[model samples]
Structures are given as C-alpha cells and as structure tokens.
Target: MYLYDHYDQAMVDARVAEFRDQTRRRIEGTLSEEKFRPLRLQNGLYLQLHAYMLRVAVPYGTLSGAQMKMLGDIADKYDRGYGHFTTRQNIQYNWIKLEDTPDILADLASVEMHAIQTSGNCIRNISADQYAGATADELIDPRPYAELLRQWSSFHPEFLALPRKFKICVIASDTDRAAMRLHDIGIQIVKNEAGEIGAAFYVGGGMGRTPFIAPLVKAFVPLDELITYSEACLRVYNRYGRRDNKYKARIKILVHELGVDEYRRQVEEEFAHLQTLAIEPPLAELERIKTFFADPAYEAGLSDDLDLSNPAFAAWVKNNTAAHKTPGYAIVNISLKPVKTLADGSKQAGIPGDATGEQIRVMADLAKTYSFDELRVTHTQNIVLPHVRKADLFTVWEKLVAAELAEANLDKITDIIACPGLDYCTLANARSIPVAQKIAERMADKAEEIGELKLKISGCINACGHHHAGHIGILGVDRKGLENYQLLLGGCEGADTSLGKIVGPGFDEDGIVGAVEKATQVYLANKEGEERFLDTYRRIGMNPFKEAIYG
Candidate 1:
C-alpha cells in the first residue's frame, strides 16, 4: 500500500478543515441546503431517503489492515455498526449524522482515506483488479498507474465539474476482472507485438438508463502518453459533452452520439495538444509509486499444496481461493455474503456487501495475521487477502468459519452482487436487497451445480449494482405504481464483456425469484459438460430460458 506523502497529508488535512467549517455552517443555518448541496457532495456526503449517507474512498479497493480496522471503528463510532461495500470499490455508511461528518472525515484523514470524489458529477474513485499485484495472470501491476491517475484526477480544476460523473478503470490482465470495458475510460496495459508496453484505450463504456460497451478508441498508446491520452479523452468529453440533460451527460452518452472514429480523432488531436503541456507524470514519479507495490518477501522453496482432507476446508479452498503469481502462495477471497436459515426453516440472506463492525475487525485481524497486513475490496462486493501462504489456508478458513465469513460460494449463485436499493437509495424504484435475498435462498441448494454465475441486481437503471454485466441480471422498476423486477440474461463482465438482455416482461418479487430459478434449471438440464451458466445461456440462447420462465 502507498503511504501518503507530506503533500498528500496536507491536502487531506486542508479538506477536512474546510469541510468542518462547511458542515458547521449548514448545521447553524448560516448556509442553505441548496448552497451546501454541492459542497457536501464534493466531500462524499449524501442526503438519502431516511438519513445522510457517507461514502469513503478505498483507492483501487486497497487498504492496509490498520485502515480496515479504522473503517470498522468508524462504523461502530459514527453510524450503525455496519458498513456497505459498494460496486465502485468503496464503502458507505447509510446512517450518518450531519454534525458528525467532519469528525468522521478527520478519522479517515488520520488513516490516509477520505470521501472525496466518491460521488458527484466529477471523476469518481479509480477502480482496478482486486488481485492486481498478486494475481498470476497480469502483465504488470496496474495499481501504480491507477494511483498516478488518482493523484492527477483528484480535484483537477478542469474536471471538478464535468458534464457528468466519470469513472476510470485500469487493469493489466487479459481476464478483465475489473470490468475494464464497462467504464467511462478503461485502460488495459498491454504488450505490443514489438514487446513494448502500452495501453489500449476503451472509451465510452457505461450502464445506466442507457448501457454501452465502450468501443476501442485507440489500440495502443505508448506508456509515456498514458496520462496525457487519458486527459485527452476527458478533454474531448468535457468540451463537447451535453450539459442540458443530466440523463445523457455521461461520456458514454457522448461517445454514443458521436461515432467512435470521430471520438478517437478528437482524442488524438487533444493528445497531440496535451503532449506539449507535459501533463503526464514523470517516469521517476511512476517508479516511486511502483516501489510501494513491490512483492512481499516470500520464503524460498515453499510447497504449493493444500491439505484437502477436511471436506469443509476443501470446499472453501476450492471456491474462495485463486492461484497466486508466486508459488506456495494463494489469493484468498473472504465472502461477505453469508446465508442463514431462520428458526422457521425459511432462509434469511445476510445483506450482500454489508459487513458488521465486528466482522470488519475480524477481517482486519486476519489480514494482519495472514495476508501481509493488506486487504482488497473486490468489484463483486467481496474482500480479498491478496497474498496468503498455501500452508496457512486451513487456519485462515477456520478463522473465517468461526467468524461466519467463510461462505464457500465464490461466483456461485449465492454470491450475489446487489445494491442497497429502495431501502437506502432514494432514486431506487423497488427493493433490490429482498429480491437478491430471495434469489440467493431459492438457488442456494443448486448454486454449486450452477457454478460461476454472476448475478447482479439494481433498484433502478443507475446500474450501481452492475446488473448490466451479470450472467443473470435483475433490474427493479416502477410498474403501475408497484415494485416489479425484470430478469436479464447473457450478461458477462469478463474479457468478453457484454450487456445482459431482458428476457421478457417484468415480474413481481416472488415471480422474479422463480423466474431466475427456472432459468438456472434450464441451464442445468441443457448444459454440456463443465459448461458454466453463462456458457449454457450463450450456447442455448434466450429462447429456451424465456419459454421456461414466461410459459
């Protein structure tokens, strides 16, 4: 993890002081809500349906154990005793007091975290692969570049008030775990045929009322021009992007209105102009950032074997762990989604991505004890102990099991990615959490059979839950003044990114859950050997699943 320098500390400290005064003024009635709206939003405070919500940034989803512990402390001290981890690789507290926000910011500042850019129509938190440095498949660790972009975009005067909020993702792997193509700006660091490293720019990807998989704007941009090219893309969007309508203000909308070729041409022209400005950070600075991400010390000649004698531990190891780039080590994922059976024998779903303060503290302790004192928040609303020794797998699993955090359902139907829908978000049309819970319970028994299914839910079209990218996506809508859920299929967020298509007419809450189960049953019955739910859906198409569900 990168430690904050003096300049970084100074800026955060200054923002805290500034916001303290702003918040005081709002509370004292010296500042009107209309006036304080943007100011509070700039600092990541939102007035939700019931109470104020505070979103704290976890840059690229990386946090030190101490930071994670502080997050737990914040949850305990300020709001309710739980925090909601979001799809943007950030965390949110649903019940925040207006007067206590400054103190919360101060607490976060001490840990080198803040709420800045977590909201508003500005560049939001930069996201990346959760297993960036430790994963076996990446070409290079992309966090350094992500950090550089973070520093560059933080309060950049030019982008502070864009036509709409912009999101950027950096991934070095070809597997696309970060949903690279579904961002406003997706930069994939790649090696060319000449064996030189560069970036492939995919601009104009987003999901909302309108969903778009950004087209490849530039196939290869030299490493030296990464920041400049990114700025060029933003400049183009800012210059011509629509300001009249909030609905069509995102860069994705601009790219849709203008063809990819023209957008690329404009970006190229801007890139040429930015080259003279020398806006890209110097190579020395990137090298300095890279130093923070170097591999942890590993004992040489360690064995890469796990004892699978215990059936429970074997299941956890099989589902929640991934191969590490270093031998004898593994990437461990802690599932936040825990399913509980009520005394009535009905299933009760633990709220997805909502980790209680005690659970967060437990995870922090585990990270410190096992994973080099580091933890990562995945885009799927899970946490990752990026580098855990294989020898300690069982102990870690045991600890997680004791904490009730070991769910052994990674990518399974039960491992759902859903937003805090009508429950917390005022913009939501229907309840998303209940729908997610129902689906999880309905499919829990068959989740192992329906393997590698990415199910996502959003209360509205904002796509905060990333429903557009799920293998089976669910969207809640307001239909005839009632909460209706729509089922979508064939969505995938990996390397072959594709938006889900709605199967047919919307259904009521129970109907939607049954519809999802029917779709899965179709997959199980028709699937070839070893085929995932997504593979089966693609091979068999929507007709079979649609007939089963609607008929």
Candidate 2:
C-alpha cells in the first residue's frame, strides 16, 4: 500500500475542508439539490433510490487491518452497520445522510482513504487484482503503476469532465484475474524481448448497453511513457467520444462507431502529439512508489509439522486457497455464499444479505490476528486475507466457520460472482443476486457431480458482475416487466480469455438455476474425469452446453 506523500496529504486535507463548507451550504439550503448534485457526486456521494450512497475508495483493493477497522467504525457510527463491497473493489454505504458526508470524508482522510473519483464521468478508482503483490505469477507488482495513475488522473483538469465515466485496470500477471480486457483502458505489464518492462495497452473495452473486448493499441509502451500515453488516450476520447447521447457517451461507443483501426490510428496520432509535451514523472518518484510495495518481511523457513488433514480445513484448502508467492503462505478467500437454506430464504431469491456488523468485526479481527492485518475485497464478492501463513490456515478456517463465513468454495462451482441487482441498484433491469444464489444452491446440491466451475451474473448489460468473463455467465434482463435471464458459456478469466457466447433464448428468472444446472450436467457427462469445466467446454465447444441448457 502506498502512503500519501506531503502533496497528496495536503490535497486531501484541503478537499475535506472544501467539502465541509459545501455540506454546510447544502444543509443550510444555500445550495439547492440541483446545484449540489455535481458537487456531491464529485465526492462520491449519490442520491440513490431510498437514500444517499457514499462510495469509499479502497485503492487497488488494498487495506490495512486498521483501515478495515476504521471502515467498520464508519459503518457502525454513520450509516447502517454494514458496508457493501462493490465490483469495482470499493465499499459503499447506502444509508448516509446528506449532511454527514463531509464528516465521513474527514474520517476517511484520517486513515489515508477518501471517496474522490469514485463516481461521475471521470476516471474512477483504478482496480488491480486483489492478489497483486502476493500472487506467485506476477511479472511485477502493479500497484505502483496503479498508484501513479491515481495521482496523475485524480482531479486532472482535462479529464474531470470526460464524455463518460472511464475505468482503467492494470494487471502484471499473464493470468487476467483483474479482467483487464474489459476495462476502458486495460494495461498488461510485460517484459519485451530486450528485457525491459512496459505495458501492452488495450483500449475501448467496456460492458454497458454495448460490450466489447478492447483491442490492443500498443504491443509495448515504455514504462516511462505510461502516464503520457494514457493521457493521450483519454484526451482523444474526451475530444471525440460521443456526448450528444448518454447511451453512446462511452469511449467504447466511439471505438464502435469509428471502427477499431480508425480508433487506434486516432490514438496513435494523439500519442505522437503528446510526446512533444510529455510530462513524465521522475524515475526517482516512480522508484519511491515502488518501495512501498516491496515484499513484506517473510520468514524463510518451512514448517513440516503443519497438519492439513482435518476435513473442514482440507475442504477449505482445496477450494478457497491459492499458491502464494512465498512458499509457506497461502491466499485465503472467505466465502460469501450463505448456507443453502438461508440463501433460498432471502427475499430477492438468489443474492445473500450483506455481511452483518458482527461478521464484519470478526473478519477484521481475523485479519489482524492471522493475516498480517491486511484484507482485500475480491471482485468475486468475497473477502481475501491474502497472506495467511500456512500454519494459521486451520485456525483461520475454524474461526471463519464459527462466523458462517467459511463455505469452503473459492473457485469451485458454487463460488458465484454477482452484483447487487434490483435489490439496490436502480439501473438494474432485473434481480441478479437472487439468480446467482439459486444457481449456487443448485450447484451445491450436485457438488459431487458439478466439480469446479464459475457462474457469474449481472442485472444488466453493464456487466458489473463480469458475466462476460465467467465460464458460465447469466445476465438478467427485463421482458415486459417480467424478470428474465440470458445464459452464456465458455468465457474465461485467465491467460487465454474470451467472452462467453449466449447459449440460446433467455429464461425467466425462476428458470435460470435449472438452465445452469442442465448445462453443468452436460459438462459433467461429457468431460474427462480430471478436466475442469473450462477445459471441458473448450475441448467440446459451446454446442454441447447449449444443447443441454436449452433442451
């Protein structure tokens, strides 16, 4: 995690003071709702369906235990006693009072956090893999680059009023856990044959009314020119991206209208122009940011006495754990899947309820006690304690079970990813959570037969849940006020990623789980015993799954 420099600290302090005054005016009626909308949105405050929602940035999805505690405190004192972890790897409080927002920002500032650039048509939070620095396969830590972009884009005068909201993702690993290809700007960190590290840039990728897998703009952008080149890309979009219609305002629309080749040519021309006035950050400054992300002090010795035989611990290890960069530690995913009965009983059908305050507190404590006091909210709607020592795995699993947070399904079939659909989001066309929950429960019932799979659901084409990247994707839609879902399959999130294709006609929300189950059964029947769902799907292609799903 990068600490704020004096410049960063000063800017945040000043912004807090400015927002405090803005708050006072809004409450005093000196500023009308119409007038205050943009001001409040710039600070990450939104007037939602029922109340104001305050989204706080968890930069690159990294948080210290103390920071997590502060978030828990904010949830306890300011709003309801729980926060919603979002797909963008941020946290949201849905019941904030308008007057309390500035105070909340001040509180967040105390912990080196804030709500800046979280909303409105500006560069939003820069997301990276939750397992960034700790992942065993990373080419390099991507956080320093993410942090640099954060500083450069935050309140960048030219970009604050872009044609539409823009998102950027940077991934250092060959495996695309961050869904880099789906971002407005996806940068893959890679080393050239000459052994110099640079970025492979992908542009115009997004998932809204229109979905696209961004095409590559540069095979290798020099490390020193990342900022300049990014600025050039945004500047081109800001200048030419559609603004006449909200539906076509995104850069993706621009890319679609102009065609990818033309879009690339435009960006290249812009890049060439930016080179004349390039304002590269000093190499020393880049190195300084990198220092903050240097590997944590890790013990070198291995403990052979560790036991992994307990059934519950074994299940958790087998399902929710991943290899760490260090030999003696593991990345642990805390499942958000409710018990089958509770999941079925929830009002919205498939979505689980927010983590209770007690659950949040337990997780915070566990992070402090067992995982170096660090926690990451994953894109899969689960929390990750990324650096748990191998020795503490069983103890952590036991504590998680007591809190009902341990379902022992990390990348398994029941570990579904879904967004807060109709339950909370006004933009949702149908309820997504319920659909995801039902599918998870269905898979759980056939846990032995289903084996490993990924099912992702999103309420609409916005693809907040990343439905496009799932091996099994479910997208919710509205048909004459009736909830319906479309099923897609064969998408992947790893090295050789591709978007899923729709299986056939859509299903009513109630029929979605059965449809998914049918598809899974086809995979099970057709697969070689040891093959994963994705491997099986690729080997057999989508026809088998589609025929089975729609049969």
Candidate 3:
C-alpha cells in the first residue's frame, strides 16, 4: 500500500478539478458526447450497456483495511450496494451517474486511490502477483517495481497515446501466478548465478484476437536498466506498431508480422542506445518506497504451536491457503465459488439475477468482518483475505459458508474464470459466463476428482478472461447469434506456462459443457492417483482429452 505524498496528492486534486470542469462543459452542451469520450475514458469512466461504469484502480492489487472500508462506503453511497471486481484486479461500479464521477474521484483520492490509466490506449494498471509480499517462494516482492512503473508511466508524455492499450506484468516467484507471459511486456525478476537480482524481459505477448506467449527479449536486464529497457521496447512498438488498422494495432501484431528474431533485434538496437543513460534509483528513494511495505510486526515463535486436526479448518488450509514467508501465518483465499453449482451454474450463483438490497448488504458485511476489514478481488473471480491469521481460519470459513462464499475448491475444476459476455458487454460476439456456469454444473458431481483444473472462458477473440492460459480453455464465438464455443487443452498458468492448443471444431452452447465433462472424464481415466489435471495433461499431451471431448 503506497501512500500519496504531497506531489501525488496535488496531481490527483488538480485532475479532479479538471474533470469537474469537463463534466460541467458536457452538461452545458459545450462539449458533446464524442468530445467528452476520451476525457472520460482517461479517468476510467465508461458508458456501458445500461449505465456508466467507473473503474477504480487498486494499484498492484494492494489495499489497506481503511481503504477497503472507503470502497465499501463508495459502493453504498454512490452506486448500487456491490462492486464488480474485474480480471485486472480493479473494481467497477456499473450504475454511476455522470455528474457524480468527479465526487467519486475525490472520495477515492482521499484514500490514495484513483481511476487514472484504467482504460484508453495508454499504459494500463501495472499488475503484479497478488500474493507478492506474503508468498514463501518469492525472491523479492514485485509490488515495489510495479509501483515504480506506475510512477514512471502515469501521464508520461511519450506513452500517453500509444498505438493500443499497453499492459505490463511483473512476477518475482518461479510460479507465474500473475500470468506474466500474457502481457504486452512481462518481466520475471530473477537472481543471477552470482546472486545479483535482475529482470528477464518478454515482449510481444498478449491475448486478444491474436494470442501469443511473449518471446524472450533479454535473458537478464540489470536492475538499473529496467526503466530504460522498458522505454526502449515501447519506443520500438510506438514507432513501428500498426496504426492504420485498429485490428492490428497491438504490439503482438507487430511481432507476428516481423518474426520474433527481428522484433528482438529491433528492441536490442533501441536498448543499446538507451543503456548509456540508465541510472538506478537513489538508495534513499528505494528505502522510502520499501518503508510503505515493511513487514507487519508479528509475535515471535508463532509457528511452534498448531492444531491440524480440525477437519474443516484443515480442508480450507489445504485448498485455499498458500505458504507464507512467515512461519506462523498463511495467505488465505476467500473462495467466491458457490457450492450450489458446477461449471455451468456460475451465472446463476452468488447474488442471483433478482438479488435484493439485503443480500448485497450481507455480502458487503461478510467482506468487512471475516477478511481483516479488507478484501482483494483476485484475477480468478475470487476474493482474497490475504492476511487472515492462521488461528482464525475456522471462524472465517464458517462465516463464508453461511454466506455461500465457501466452496472449498480454490484451484479445482469447478472454479472457472469467465468474463461478462454478450449478456453485458456490447463488444462480445458470444455468451461466456453462462457457458462457464454450465460447465461448472456439469462437473459438479466429479468436482473433487477433476482436481485443480482451470477452465477459463472468453466471450470473443478479445480474450479478456485469458482463456488461452487456462488448463482447459473455452472460447465463445457467435454463428448467426447462436453461441459456439471452441475448446483448447493443455494450457497452464504456473511457472512452466504454455498456451493451450485448440481441440477440434467448435461446439454449440448446449454441447460445450458436455464436451468439457468428457474432457475431464478423460483426465480422470488417465490420471495416476493424486496426480493433478495439469500434470496429467503435460505428461500425456492433448490427445486423450481431445479424443474424449470430440468423440
């Protein structure tokens, strides 16, 4: 949680004043809808299907308990009772009035949060691993780097209007929980053989109409040159990336047109020129940023006593928990997967289509109480109580179960990631959420057997849900308004990341879940005892799943 200094505070306050004037002009008929489009977009406001949607940035997905309370207050006072957490770890309020946006921004500014760079062709939010500081396996926390990038890229004149939206991800651990390989620029922080820290750069990776795993650009970019090298890569893309055709404007398209080798060469040439000016941040500045994230004081010798016999607590610990760097604590994921349905029922789960005000309040209170007065909306559509004490695991689980938020399946097959498709998004060509729900429902009976399968769905080729990185990928497309889904197998989201390969022809909405069921059955039939679905898929390739799914 980086706090805003006077400089940062002044910038936000000035932006709010500017947007206030802009809104007044628009309302006064001086600025038309077309004229206000870019202005509003720059502030993360969008005119959606029914109402205006305002996306607030949760920088690197970090927030304090007080900040969470502020967000809850915003939800209650400004829009509807609940907020929709997006795949990028940002939160969206769908029913905002146009006039109230500036006020909302002011409210967010009070908590050192804002809506800047959340949309538009400029660099979007710099995301990192959600479990950055807490994870036991991380070489270093990636948030500080993410924060550095945020400061550098925010309103940077050179990159304010790139060819298309630019996204960057930083991962510090061996595991790619942040989906580092699926961004415009992905940096894996690694310690070299001599034990010096540096970044491994990957470029031209994205998931949209053209999905690609970023090719390696530099094996080891020194820590001092990260910003310089990144600027060089962006410069190359900005100069040569497609601008005439919006369809091919992304850096991925440029890389596809000019093979990876040539793209690497171009970036190298640019990097060589900028390397001379590269300088590391001052030690004092680095220490100042690090201070914001200093480890919270914990009682010493906390790991020595433990009771593992509580079955409910043990199940939650085993499934939704990850090892923390601290001995006495664990990072807890508050599962949003409703146990009422399997894959296909996600759309119908949680607050139903006809949910009332009371239900939304209950959901909000559940977050406020059990989750350290703070909750992180994960990229996987689940909420995380990232700092839950190990001792309180049972109490949290009990509360979550009462609210239908406890599914006991954190990485299992039923915990599908899906986007709002034709149902909500005007850009979608096919429905995605319903299809994901149906798949979840189909696999409900064999939920435990499927074991840690990631089924990701994208409504269209835009790949917003990152279907390409799923262990099992489902892409929905439209054929004359009829929903058709294409299944891809063997994708992974961990350290050994790989893009999924498409199976056979696409299946109709009715047939897609059956196809998924068949694929899972194939996995069950072929898997050795206790072997996860991903391990089985990797060991035996896609043939078995393909045969079963298609046949």
Candidate 3 wrongly placed segments (more than 4 Å): 275-283, 304-310, 341-348, 351-375
The TM-score that candidate 2 achieves is 0.94
lDDT (tens digit, per residue) of candidate 1 on 1-551: 99999999999999999999999899899999999988899888999999999999999999999999999999999988999998989999999999999999999999999999888889999999999999889999999989999999988899888999899999999999999899999999999999998889999999898999989999898877888988999989988999999999999888888889888888889888999998888889989999999998876788997789999899999999999988899999999888876798877788999998999999999999999999999989999999899999999999999989999999999999999999999899999999999888888878887889999999999988889999999999999899999999999999999999999999999999999999989998998999999998889899999899977
- Provide the lowest-lDDT 10-residue window in model 2: 344-353
RMSD value for candidate 1: 1.0
lDDT of 3 by residue, 1-551 (tens): 57889999998888888989999999998999998988898889988777888988888777766666667678878877767667787777878999999999999989888899898888898888888877888899887878878887888788877899999988898888888888899999999999998899988888888788888888898777778888888899989999998879999899879998899899889889887774446546656787877666645666524476877667667788877777666677766555474375443444211122333344446445544444555677666666656666677677766766666778777777877777667678888867776776667658776778988889888888788889899898887767888998878767778888899999998888888888888888889988888788888988877777765
Which candidate number would show the highest TM-score if scored against the true structure? 1
Residue pairs with backbone atoms closer than 3 Å in model 1 (clashes): none
- TM-score rank order: 1, 2, 3
lDDT of 2 by residue, 500-526 (tens): 888888999667878888887888788
Q: Determine which window of 10 residues in candidate 1 has minimal summed lDDT.
A: 340-349
Q: How many residue pairs clash in each candidate?
A: 0, 4, 13
Q: Give candidate 1 misplaced runs (Cα > 4 Å).
A: 342-345
What's the TM for model 1? Answer: 0.99
Score every model by TM-score. Answer: 0.99, 0.94, 0.92
The Cα error of candidate 1 at residue 179, in Å, is 0.7
Candidate 3 overall lDDT versus native: 0.78
lDDT of 2: 0.83
